[model samples]
Target: MNSILRITVCAYLLSGCTFANSEAMPYKSWRLGFSAPNYMEVWIESADVVDIKEQVYPRAMSGTAAIQTPLNNTGDPRGWPEKPGIGKGKNVTGADLPKKIYVRWQSLVEPQTYQMVINVPESTRAIMRKEEKAFCAFDGKWITDYRNALVINLAPGGMAKIWVMGSCLPAIEVTKVKAVVDPRGPYEGKSGGKYDKLSDQSKAYVEKFGVPYDSWK
Candidate 1:
């Protein structure tokens, strides 16, 4: 082959190899799920890494940006519960009740698990244990192994299908479940300052599952 043609072919082959290597790298993927009573907002932020931007759910807080459960039968075509009392064999309809919310994200560079933190609005009244089952799609199949994931519970007042958040938790050796409640009102302490005033157990929950500062403001 001519010199120029040989060089061009070699360059193309090198580029192809590079692309293949990039594609083969197992990019990190994450899924986060949680349930709460009342309007709940979630934020995922990096603690060790300064460059990684914090992630916010619902994108915006106004209008339809808030993460919430279905409003009615028309709102939930999947037949998920739209109100509380499903466990008691009773049906109740309302906007303010326990609601489930889930968020997911993936990245080419696997995030440092220990540096990750979760933040919620200070308005959160209580964190309830999720009694229902949750699932996620992996390799085009649904995975229901809760033991392999982190679970956070909150008592938001609404009803909807199981849509829980999943993601990495820092320093978590095994799958962990955490529950927490805000002791103050939405306007209390100007952000999550109230987190510092929580009881020892509640404070430990914030340390383990939540970011150091409030992300709501």
Candidate 2:
């Protein structure tokens, strides 16, 4: 092969190409945290291709395993089995970030689907660039578990507060978006037993499985 052709092949391989000519970037797996008066459908845009959590639910501010389940990187999706070819994930830099995360909800009286987009903050992406800097305190020492996190905190009157769950870098509010409230009103529910309200089967899984840091559980 010519010198230029050989160099081109090397560059492609180094870029973390999975499918020929396809662009796959490495993303610090981040999970979705849901907190609202009523249950709403939520998903990360393009989550499947990026190895992110798609189907998910975890209390946003419980401060427990609700958002702290996977404290160890040893079980991370990209390297969980401790075996090669099992975790097929690319390692892209921060330049490939800014996943277009979207949230939508509708319940009870407020049957109209309310939608909004929460863009990833440059601050969080900056942290992902430096894995050493992103961290979370578990037991005693710090760990880089919750690096690429995204949060949704909904309130009455169609208000939403999005946050970057950077843990050690300290969680930061990324943006806030408000939708027009329906004439009926927001969905009303009790927070005291949010988990208890779930079906018996779901609650059982919650007790055993924790929503991981990298992908949405």
Candidate 3:
């Protein structure tokens, strides 16, 4: 082949090789895992403006209750899970408790550290005229609002686990959990104002879990 034609062919081959290499490399991903007693649900709000909602059933019923977030674009949060709710009278109590209840979250994105905020209320069960309810514990301490959430660094393809433990009886079921993403480091300055500007729920979360590192502006 002539010099110019040979040069063109070599360039085309090199471009193809570059494309193949890019496709072969794995992208960054974030994942969350947890296990509970009764039915559980998780909501993921990603940095890419996507929302994911997953519901996990009991192992005894479905033979599998492991839940994972869908890696797809959800335009609006309200449009997802429009139904009323789950686990009304179907609660498992006493010896009939579920065997397995696990939830997970996974996503592919730019490699960077992220943080997770979990809400574990103190005695979600309330009795009008009954005795006070007991709280759940983790790592030898009660899982209160102050100790419910956690912050961790996640590298590419890394996974963060949050083990949930509690009773599976009626009025004591594990219903919902919210997981927010801090694309920036947990200690980075806040994009918006300080805690005052956050939503009521967020404000409550701050009160319980404390503000993230350097998050306040």
Question: What lDDT tens digits, residue by residue, belong to model 2 across residues 32-107?
Answer: 5554321221221111112121121211122211211132222222111211111111222222444334343432
lDDT of each: 0.23, 0.36, 0.24
Q: Which stretches of candidate 1 lie over 4 Å from their true place?
A: 1-33, 37-67, 71-146, 157-184, 191-217
TM-score of each: 0.20, 0.40, 0.19
Model 2 global lDDT (CA atoms, 0 to 1): 0.36
Q: Cα deviation in Å at residue 4, candidate 3?
A: 56
RMSD of each: 20.0, 16.6, 20.8
Tens digit of per-residue lDDT, candidate 1, span 18-99? 2111111111322223333222322221111000122212311111112243322122112222332211011111112222
Write the candidate numbers in order of decreasing TM-score: 2, 1, 3
Say which candidate scores most in TM-score: 2
Model 3: which ten-residue window has the lowest total lDDT?
47-56
lDDT of 1 at 78: 23
Model 3 TM-score on a 0 to 1 scale? 0.19
- Per-residue error (Å), model 2, residue 40: 11
Using lDDT as the measure, what is the rank order of every candidate, best first? 2, 3, 1
lDDT of 3 at 122: 24
Model 1, residue 137: displacement in angstroms? Answer: 7.3
Better of 1 and 3 by lDDT: 3
